[model samples]
Target chain A: MNAANSGSDMPAWLVIERVVRSHWSLSARGERDAGAVLLALWADDRRDLGEGFLLRAAYLGASRLRVIELALDEAAPAFPSLVEIYPGAVRMECAVRDVLGVQADSADSRAWLRHAGWPVDYLPLRHDADRSARFAAQAEDYAFVRVEGDGVHEIAVGPVHAGTIEPGHFRFSVVGEKVLRLEQRLGYVHKGIEQRFSQMDLQQGQRLAARVSGDTAVAYSWAYCMALEQLCGTRVPARAQQLRAVLLERERIANHLGDLGALGNDAGFGFGLTQFSLLKERLLRANAEVYGARYPMDGIVPGGVATNLSSQQIERLREQGMVLEAAVVELRAIYDEHAGVQDRFVTTGRMSPELAQRLGVVGLAARASGSPRDLRSDLALAPYAGLGVQAAGSAQGDVAARVAVRFDEVIESLRLCDLLLQDLAGGAIHAELGAAAAQQLGIGLVEGWRGPVMIALEATVDGRIRRCHPHDPSWQNWPALEHAIIGNIVPDFPLINKSFNLSYSGQDL
Target chain B: MLDILKRIARTGIVSEPQLKLADLLSERDTLHAEIAGILGRALAIRQVDAGSCNGCELEINALNNPIYNIEGAGIRFVASPRHADLLLVTGPVAKNMEIALKRTYDATPEPKYVVAVGDCGCTGGIFGESYASCGRVSNVIPVDAEVSGCPPAPTAILRGILSALASPRR
Candidate 1:
């Protein structure tokens, strides 16, 4: 679709035009923003990677005809801080500063990178670090949002948690059971992933993307491969595309199963946990049997899938899927009918539809908040478009609504998986992706288990990746967590947080 | 009684021992083997997330599910300076997770072995390091054995653990 006429569905494009008023080459581009068209441009190179491009939208309130030069340099690019214009861009700009070495020349350039357990001298995204240099051990005082009141206390939870979960420090300023302010201190699990990419080949890099978050393997892998393919101008075989859809659907269902169970368990319903856990186990086992991996990683390569599913495997998948569906239906009825569970989840952690829209929360959480922005449908790509998939959403913006959205998505994914299997095409699984042409930039967007994952790939001469920026939905949604838990009780944080299970690692990257 | 029976029916059956002696004997043997496995060798495991997208962590938590029972294997994830005999970390360690990767390695107690479970942990199985990633676990952390597949079936993770325990580096 053409950029001007593409309506909300138009692909994001970067267009350079010369302003008649100024000699500078004005760079203007369109990005999909909450079902609307938003333009972002900047005049500096050093701030480009960190501020202009990194921050979703930075509005400069100067002359309308001011010439803007689009900066796409590997080392550094400059962009004006929109924190003054659009306060929402603050966290995003800070994130860019942490990973990418591009420092935001904004007013608030405090000790963002040196917080928690991150090494100070090293910037993970920069390519200058030596491979053998031992990461220096440094500990700096972490600054958290302070709150003072009568009978109010603060609880500092660990970067090393009680469970086997990743390290993230949660500081809650609370009065008895009511939480006044909750500030998150993450980066404890920060590994120099982006920096290490310079030292590895494309294949190795793809592995890292998939592991960004373990659950959303298909989404991250596909997003990475899509970026790679776009850079090299490779066409994935139709069969491979279909297989990818199947893998993605499988991942969606598996995650839903686990989430459903966990949500239930969180509300003191052990039966739901046991039943859903059992269902999840069966599904994972089937996944392992068919895809050789339970979570289905390495399934999507640059040009196509690394492996193919056989007829027998497909049949087995169908059978297991059917059984799981039946169990889900049965278990869901039990959950829906349970009064105590329903009461706990119904309106416990409510993020009003209006607030959700303003914050731009995506995935199931967004859907629950009445934002119907599904990349699969709204930004339809490949097999999903062909299949005529319908995106599901809710407007309640509550924990129960989130749970319901997940359930609806699980059912929809099951249907999609069945259709994909039935219409499985026979063809070569892969196409040879030749080296990327120099200075080629490609954008990849895929709906992950959590939400839409956006990846931008820039290649250098000889096909080496110059810069890659994979934006997880969590980047936008993590802040929403801070907002969602505002009025809720301190104990309900887990329930609310679980509803929108944003990945700290995914966001940090 | 009828209500209880009906509720039981809704869930599933409650299994009773068919042969108490045989059950006792099997349980004893299983316990004996588990203890023996723990005593036989000190296992060093390094977790590499080939690419898991963390759904596996839920199940990994369930490994200590108090039922399927992981600790009974005498397996524990260690975090400190050279105390970990096994390195059990997760993730396709994203680009940001790279330094943590080296630190995890540096902290491992000597003669440490690595077991990369989950697909992402193995070969950067899925989320190959994109612009946001360093790619695979092996890229940052030195790996000994790879438990391939996206979050290798917990059974696979178990098998990988067993294999790591069996093979000790001199």
Candidate 2:
């Protein structure tokens, strides 16, 4: 389709454009808006500018992305919350409120990311945020919205969960086994990662990014480095990009294997857990042997990847890939054929396509609900573009659909891994980055195992990071669980949750 | 069911033997007996993630895989701290999770052990002493043993648990 047809297809963007234009016309417009246009970002030496906070919102279309920026006056920082357009923005709006002290012009003004860790006035991301201040113990209990009525009881599930999982509290209002409402109290894992980013040099910041969510380490680090490289105008070698793809694809497979097993275990099938976990273990061992780190948290660096492979190493990986693909295919057939497992998974945690689009759920969860917009295919970047990565999709938006998408993606990723190994470009694995050019705003978006991991970097003229916002697609997904769990029994929550598998730290940051 | 049985038959048992000294650190068999003897049953561990990147938790979970078969070694991760003999904690204690972690610790019966898992748990790793962080796991609760790696591998984590159980409290 041409630009005109695509433009007409976008209702949300058209509405946002109209809203921005009206706001521009209502107020005394600045020189920035020639004809009520979307404000161009990183303009006019933003590095040296006064304390004006930037509000950035990215709308990813079928083949295009529109990033809208509104420069709010720092003194009275408030913007119209996108919660109306994207209900997922409510928690994020609260995060901005707690972290940067930015007010969202919305009714729901609950605190997020700040569990009374700091005083209200002491926003950690403010220009004058002090590093030495200490706060006393939090005195108040979070007032979760109570579900009122007779026979309606509440079950509080955790900040520290039952298993070896990340911490997040879930409040389930249920009458017997049927869930009435599910209110999630996340940000229990907030470690001041965004605040920590501001203190690092551009080169040192990627380490923190990698830790944003441990499972998606490769994606976060790559995105962070991608942004930094963009700012510094560094050229990553073709070999490095290919190695990065290998690591990225491996990370995806590892996570999928783990989750698939967990989903089975949650559904009461121990055999599924045993087989998938074994496969996952084998993959992790290969990672440790090849990359020198089981998780490879530091594998992807600023200009390129951390490690290079020899031709023999490439051949070894190729042989391993074939074995994994065959085993995964075998397992997929078993999952599809198992009547007991299929009965439990088929209709559990069903989120309608309408609800998914309305709530702005992205990534694999979005794909399960029929959108199927994978960044690898959507953005069509180097290795992914050439490898012809197929976007795995389904319309059921149930646990079964999510499982199918994962299985399909793993098969596709295995195929890509083989192709990537066959076509290795020989060169330096990393490039030394030069001084970052002043007044550049670097943005990097990579398709992580969970979803799209995005990093927005702003560095000082001297190369220290000024402000960085690392966003996880979990922010777009976690809320969907609340809706999906409404009709399901309390026992199925774990299966539904693992199917979505949204990262707690990704959003908690 | 038949396919599952066949797969299990093919996969056999990848879990380490009872006396795989080289697999774990020194004194693997003795530590296992000590743990099983101490509890007189399975050693129930309750894992508490204070504010980790969840990388450490990944390794902790890896201990459950058939290759590690942490359960076969007479240890199982229980849901409730009240039912636990040990607390496996990960991450630098986020200020928000401080009270929750503390509550979890208090809920566990006395003579309970807490093994700090991961570099973040031991020394706060990269996120040391931040405005929102309390640094190490010790900052929130008493830790008996420490596992220090970006995220200590499953074997290292298993070794840390053995050390924590075999040795006395700090």
Candidate 3:
């Protein structure tokens, strides 16, 4: 097996190597409460990457970073669960158990990512299990932890929401109108993306990554392609890199616009929704005309990008950015001055910096709560390194803080967009990439609008994908939601949830 | 409030002019794309994400924007399936979401129509059929019409709904 070190974070890499020091040099064995476990997932080594069965786990940490993993064989098919250290790792550890049959020693030992839709032994990711096998709908009865009190009662919200949103069940324990606990039951949108990735070649997998979560298509696809290019040692052109930046920034702005409006609407401001929706529509129309897709799902491909902007098109984009900046500034003022909105937003759904740090929250939500860990700014690469990126954040850690971060980012993105247009890289838009070598593994990480979207891809001897694990930031942040809603009232849960906007589909897979 | 009103007035109904279904006919879209205003009565739609990538949801949400201004037309998204006349479902039906989708479909009253939005809803697009996916919206519930795009644009999606509404009630 190629223990190709994922040197995305160099400091963490050294720590990981030291912690998991052994012959194979990867073991989280007997380390029960060893720091925060960012992601705990296992790959079936019977397919490739090794000769026999294998298991692994690693640290995707920013606070007191430490890495640990154990290479499991047929005999030792379990690893010590780090759910206690990384409180966020509970769901991931459960997911690992359900899909791969790799057990973990955690107190909250429960099934995740699967309801009774499949057989109890039906681990689709296991080597012995048939990949295309189907299962009948069995009885589903997930035992949600109940709160025992005189007046405390449960309020089940969804697997289906009121609006045109994704599906996930929220079980809220309430007394009167104030909430005591909020437990989220996701995996309602689990599309078997990880298993599906093995069936596709690298090019086809790029398309699958785009669909992992539709909102952050540019970021996901770029991360997938980056991993592929890294494996093949293909150098992307300067112009293509710049264009990818343009697409990524635009994607970031569009999502922030959507969330910004939703935040206001949640607090009962119709004007905010109307004005922001109008602006978003204008931006989307421009995207369709320029990138040929409103969401630009196919914008970023392996070697470079699929499309390029003309000088006139670039100029038009700059103009749109300027207009958006002016509109956002005006909207921010209205949101700030408005009494009803501020009353709802200010102290409601607050998570302190310490709680955020302990839970290991990453991405925009983390930044808002005062963890300045942005991949673009922290690990400045080609485009982001050259065109300066100022990470927008606040220490308040409320709906208002998240709003402030979004507003700051939108303006910064506009500036970056204008800068990119002014200094458009003059070269070929795409570079022809060669085939991947035998038994190669590579890691690709991008700071998506939500947080770091990482794609760990490994190719077989003949160059087909053996295993591809797409890690979403939602896995870490979703647990933070459970904590964020602690003392907040039932009415403010929606606003708090919107502030985080964690992805069900991204994490479910 | 004056600032809000002035800004609203300045923006002033940027909603697109609705064309008759005949004028909107392309060789490909001629079948499903229909006139939006034909259903003069307001439409109450309950959108279900059977298991979409949420690309379809993004565009579906776009229908609310001023330019498309879906409410300006007779169509509006409702809170409950019981209140809905049409079910706008998206994504290839994931196996886990199948039972919930079925329950939701059952909750909506009779004479309701279903329009599966996006390529996934239509034909299970990219992540076709898997252990986790039921492949298409029709796999769980009956579908009246389908709009196929990675995510069909807001206009195409609106037309698909209107077209489904044009059909005889179930």
Candidate 4:
């Protein structure tokens, strides 16, 4: 993949050709013909750029990420919508329209992120938008697509829930018990994270990035730092790279452990919940003792990691990892053999491989339905490039398949961590980063435990952050959950939801 | 099922003896004296995520784990605010959720204490007062006790809960 010269003013067509020929390239094109060419490449994965309203498309196989700078000189702040070609572009375009006051030239232009919080004219992401201004509170009634029928009934759940969970509204149109359609309304957790990102310096940005989603803090921070390091042409030490891998795997283990527990609990199996929760708790304690923070919030900083693991700490983690493996192996057998658990899991909330592909489902959810796209294996960086990660996948896209994929990934992550710890390279934990070039853009992509997390970063000449967009795997998988819930009874929603375990705050940001 | 029973038998009551209220509760005697008559030894908590990073929520969930055994300490997380004696709110209040948070507070019966958990709950943490955010939990509703870690550890959360019970307002 050619790292296209930012200084070179390449024509839009040539830039597109370069990106198509190579796997990945960063090319700069003039404002003219940017939207037309990008609209031509509309079938590819395209996302909204920051407040500047540029369009980024990753053409060919999910490998090349190309950003097309839209000409803002038009009478109205509008760009051609890619929704006609790529179905996934609907929400991405709507989000940009909702926050940055950019419009997409397509129908179904209802707001996505803005939920009766701000005045219709106020755009929060714009530089001139008032941060402290308060809008009068009003009751919100979202126009959820109605299903008119003899037996169709709507059941609204959450934004707050029965269980202690993050807030999001789930409006289910149902015929008796079976769900006909499920529409989700989120952004109840949005805290203006993107606006806050611009207010922080390069180093401080990582701390804010880590909070994008607490569970995937390491993944988010690593991706943000990777983008910054790329802009500055800074290479992290080999040892630091290995340590980052270790921490990432540890995070994966902890989340999988917790999700497995919650899934069991949702299925009415209390024993599984207790056992798996205990396992997750032990791993978290180990994280606190060894890595400083229970969750590795401030662990990964720009140019490298914030903390270094001593040999003694490494030995302890390895021993604990082995013990965890043995325990989980035994637990898996019990979960598999238990008749009641199997009954609840099999064929429940099943999604076919074809539907999953059409919906662009990703991460563990996609792998369960046999999509077989894992960023660690596909876009291997650093230790993962040589580590040979075995992407966990299953042909069946049911609750059972999701659970099985999680189990397989947990085992794989444990093995990967052991290898990373044993082969600890000798070098400084962090490398001093040089000054970043002005008006430069860099992208960092990491396979977070949930799925792929991509961070696009732009820095000013003086090294202040211009714009940072942290894209969560939740954006791809949340719609998949709506599909997963179809044909299943209302009671099974919690179980099915836990299997995917999409992050609300991550997506809300 | 038999295997599960056998495993449980082998484990043989892994739960530690319930800690004395004085040991876990902050403001020990004051909390015991305040809640001893009305609430007795039991307290039902309803947790609200005003607008959090979910890090604080993770620690809140940790309270339910075997080590902490918050239930064993006579505090349990309830489903609805109507059933709760205390509201454990986490994050800075997002503008979108401000109404819902206030509604939850309104719905709760009298003698309901609110313990603001984590730094965000205490003072809005990193995402302070902004157009989209109202800063801290107190900015939206009255707070009884404030816990102040980026995500206060599970123990800190329990202490905060205990302190809320001790507050004379309750």
Candidate 5:
């Protein structure tokens, strides 16, 4: 078994000692206190573990995953909600209740994923939850918050959109064109991915992970594979690490380019869209030529990547990188100087740094809002550790801020791609990853283009995946989108939505 | 802004090589003539993502990009299903999304066609008939044309769109 140093280089504050792990095996009250102390001390993020309904929290300072087994067999499964400490835990708490039947004593628990499809008592992710049962379609009136005043009205948009985007219902409480409140309901695309993971072998689970969000396929697959490799004690080759980094950076550049164009289009700049879209198409075609998939789906597997690149392909990629950089820099100037775009973007959908902190906004959105937390730099995992990554950020946290962040990231990623290709080492791109040990827990966090994409894997004795929870940065950023639009006019909704561009499928899974 | 205009002038007509229907249609003899006759110079499409990974949606979106230049081919996506001539459905119809997909299919006028894009849409790719998923697009509604790829290329999706237009009316 290849144990390439089990996260030993993490900072001292980030380390959760073995004693802390055992401390969580406590009475419900003790668990609540422990969670409070963890949040107060260092924990920055929360994730719902599908196995045993375990609630896991992690830190960006030092790479540590603290699991609080909420459902102890001896007692009734209940724990004081972490919402008091980490307000971000509210959604995770509701999702855990909806999926795993573990209750968090939070004020708002109106069934997150239930979505009028599942019965009140039915928990989809529970081991004993009957799979054969069919749910007849029904529409339950979602209790959207009311804004009653003179000229106040409510506008409901989508589960089916006019654009070629995914499904998510958005309710806007508006006083004329100005948005008073914005509440979004997601989970229309929930395909039971967590339960599906248990049925597949470890390698198949990697494929499933990539599909969690197609745009961030490399991020999800890499996170999943990283978790599995750590669990099986497999050391990925240096060449594989280099290739994975290349793919990841490519994915980042591609998504950011597309988004930058869309954001431009949203702000009524068709010239920016056409120019940026042309540049982005070149990148996609280049990706298809080099990686064999436009989006890098299934390119990353359990042990390592699926394919190796020849030096000629590397040269082509480097050339494309140069072209893309020039085009983006040219377009960035256009975006900045254009009065129409600036007028719409400058203060529209403003989110203050303090509000971002309070809401626990994450990923690119968080970084744009003066939160300089980046997993690549903060958690310094391999390839990234060797090649120092500077986090791109802005203080504004508006549509302009997000756009600026994307442009900065695109340029940085292109530079990284060139470096990765130049520094490509010679070796096998894949390692032989064997069966995972029984009852093992593995966690992987990757800084995807949008933000941090995290995956927690648990394997059974027979090497089958016990449970896999692929968490997207969208989980944290989606609520920030709602908050970002509080004061913006209704017409500016599309522009704001495009700027953030949170994934419905990623969040739904 | 002046720089952008100058750049556009310098690189006159930077659009990628246009996709000819003849070359694409020659590969499939089934609906080549019929689709061309029916579609003429315009086809209004409405995209319904039943439960895709958004891979197919990205590719479908790519169809509208400058290089693919689908608009030049006289195909455009409409906001409303009622205004659509074809329904381009992607993803492995999830149980939750089944009714919505059907409602969309039913909402479209009688002469409309449904083209299932992506392997998932065609045959429920990886996440197959499970408790939460209803498998392929055909499982929920009749699919006239099946474009098979994990997420088919933009050219292939366009072909699927054409084939569905040419498909026999039920």
Candidate 6:
């Protein structure tokens, strides 16, 4: 195995071979400290493609960021645990232990999360496990982070909440009204998405990705398609790329609008919710009229988009845009004038740039805190690159900053969508994706509405997916919630949480 | 106050006042029908999430949208085995959700009606079963009606619910 030294002196890409054996090759790329590691396992046979496993490890070294990749042999071998090396690996390791049934030789193996929810013997991701089985087994209790202090009362909230939202448990340790510490207990929304992917083909898989988080359908589907296209070596049509961008931006605008309203409502501004909801309703209706789906699922496919827009539709979009723009301008003025709304949002739930960096927060939360790391702008993918993407960010690192970032993003998205509509080119909506050639691995990074959505697709020679990992920005930002809630009054938790609006299903997946 | 005025000025001038009035009347009519339908029969709904991320639930809750109402449909999501007549579930049931799948099914009071809304819920439209799923709602649950599209438009969802109610229970 090739090992690279940590520090600024290190090269952008470190190629590691025979890390475990001849069967696996690991490539650690990007800057030495702030880089990602890609591990590709050589498939000796087509069956091995279905059987092989790829594991990703992300951590921050003393000076730089460290990411390691491990590819397991079909005959799973005992590998040394990286949990000792990077404490973050503990969660990932436990995940692997539960899903892949890989026995990790670690001291912290006190049922990390593998509650007896499933039959003790059945690993859902594995091929042989019979799905239709009896459910007499009881779920094992998850180990929550422990907290202790005088007057530090522990408040446990929801696997089931009062609102019509997904299930998640929040454990708050507060000294009277001030929050001392906040520990989130997720996985209530864990529906075994990764395991389900094994049962689907490329066409079916795209649909699944879109549903990974309903709101992020456009991002998840695009990321999934990117991975599939890479594996299949298919080039999407330029028009299709433009269409995808339009849909993605629409999704972004819709969500941000809704969030802005929801955050306002959470902070005791119902008028904001009403106005935003009306705007959102209008936007969603426009989407349905144009894309045939309000949320725009199945619109993005592997090679290209599933549908096309006509001149008439484009004209309708422009008309709708005029309406939305006016509404946004109106709302912006209201939000600006509302000192009461400003008071709650300005300094509450502040996360410093240093703290954001340490927690590895991505998307708007990170950007608001002065981390100008936008995948659309920095990565410069096709349609985004053409738009001359200008990222708007702030160092306030507070709820106001996050809201500002979202507002800016909404405006930027509207501009991009209009540009895309204006630059509508005539071409085929989609291309036929052929079978895979060799055992190949492909990575997909899309700027989802929430933030950067990363999807890694691995396939066998016969075009079957080996392992697909769709990483939502929520994974990185969820932890930041715990920190943001600190020092704030317990009542402000809802508003702070709403400002970020991280996904339970996204992170649990 | 200036901002409010600006908002009024900025609001879109869609010639929908007449359409809005018509829709309002129609919505009221639908509400009456829905209430009558609910009162006439205990409508059991099976919620099938073909494959949504669950945003539709927000709007679904809006069935109680306060204004564009649904309780008049006498619609209720039953949680217990005996009380549930309609199974209103969501998502293209993820692989992990399969067990919860059976539990949800077993928990539902039989002679239940199923309404699969959203494309994923209907046919595993987008999120076909992949490494993370079990495919469509029908794959696990016995779906009676399929509401198509990524997320069936809310109107589409209402239509599906109405249609499911129209159908005979098995």
Q: Write the per-residue lDDT of candidate 3 for residues A1-509, one digit (tens) a residue.
A: 33335543232222433222243222332332343336545555563436345555545543322333355656556666666555676787788778887777663666788888887688877756787788766558989999999999999999999988899999999999989999989999998998898888888889999999999899999989887887777888988998998999999999999999888889999888888988998899899999888899989999999998898999889999999999999888888888899999898778888989888788899888987777788667668887678998899998899899999989998998899889987989899888775455566778899988888787876777888888888988988899999988998988999999989889887
Our model 4 lands, by Cα RMSD against the true structure, at 4.9
Worst 10 residues of 6 chain A by lDDT: A37-46
**Model 4 lDDT, full chain set:** 0.79
The alpha-carbon RMSD over the true interface for every model, in angstroms, is: 6.3, 1.0, 0.9, 1.2, 1.5, 5.3
Docking class of 6: acceptable
Model 5 DockQ (Cα-based): 0.66
Tens digits of lDDT, candidate 2, A16-127 = 2212423522321321122121111111112137736766555566554445556667577777765554566678778777877777788377787787887888888775
| lDDT by candidate, in order shown | 0.63, 0.81, 0.81, 0.79, 0.77, 0.66
How big is the positional error of residue A443 in model 2, measured in Å on the Cα after superposition? 0.7
Number of clashing pairs per prediction, in order: 79, 0, 2, 0, 1, 51
Q: For each candidate, C-alpha RMSD in Å?
A: 7.0, 5.1, 3.7, 4.9, 4.5, 6.1
Judge the docking of candidate 2 as incorrect, acceptable, medium or high: high
- Native-to-model Cα distance after best TM-score fit, residue B139 in candidate 1, in Å: 15
Per-candidate DockQ values are: 0.21, 0.80, 0.75, 0.72, 0.66, 0.26
Docking class of 1: incorrect
lDDT of 5 by residue, A127-209 (tens): 66787766766676777778899999988887889899998889999998899999888888888888788779887898899
How well is each residue in B1-170 modelled by candidate 4, as lDDT tens digits?
Answer: 78788766765655544433446544544555566666765788899998988898888887787767767656789999999888999899988899999999998988789999888889988888777888899998999999999878887887788777766763
Local lDDT at A36 for model 2: 22
Q: Can you write out model 4's per-residue Cα lDDT over A1-509, one digit (the tens) per residue?
A: 34434533221212322233122122322221232112111111113333233445542134334554443322356666655545555777778777777777783567777888888888777767776788765678888999889989999988888888898999999999999999999889888888888777888889889988988999999999888887787879999999999989988999999999888888899888888878888898898899877887888899889889889999999999999999889889889998899999999989899777666677888899987777788767787978999999998999999999999999999999999999999989999988876556576778899987877777877778877888887877788888889889999999999999999889888
Ranking by DockQ: 2, 3, 4, 5, 6, 1
Candidate 3 stretches with Cα past 4 Å from truth are A1-42, A47-51, A61-69, B19-41, B168-170
| Candidate 6 lDDT over residue span B70-161, tens digit each | 44445565434356566666666654455555676786655566776655576655445443455677788777776765455555566666
Give residue A273's lDDT in candidate 3 (0 to 100): 85
Q: Model 6: per-residue lDDT, tens digit, A188-300? A: 45556665665566667887787778788889999898867766668788899999999998989988988888888887887787678777877877877887766677789
Q: Evaluated on chain B only, what are the TM-scores of all the candidate structures, in order?
A: 0.66, 0.91, 0.85, 0.87, 0.87, 0.68
Return whichever of 1 and 4 wins on DockQ. 4
**Candidate 1 per-residue C-alpha lDDT over B1-170 given as tens digits, one digit per residue, 9 for 90 to 100:** 34324544775632213112465435534644653565564333334332234555755755533334444445555434355566665666654345545665676666666767665676654445443345566776676676765444555565666566566564
Better of 3 and 4 by TM-score: 3
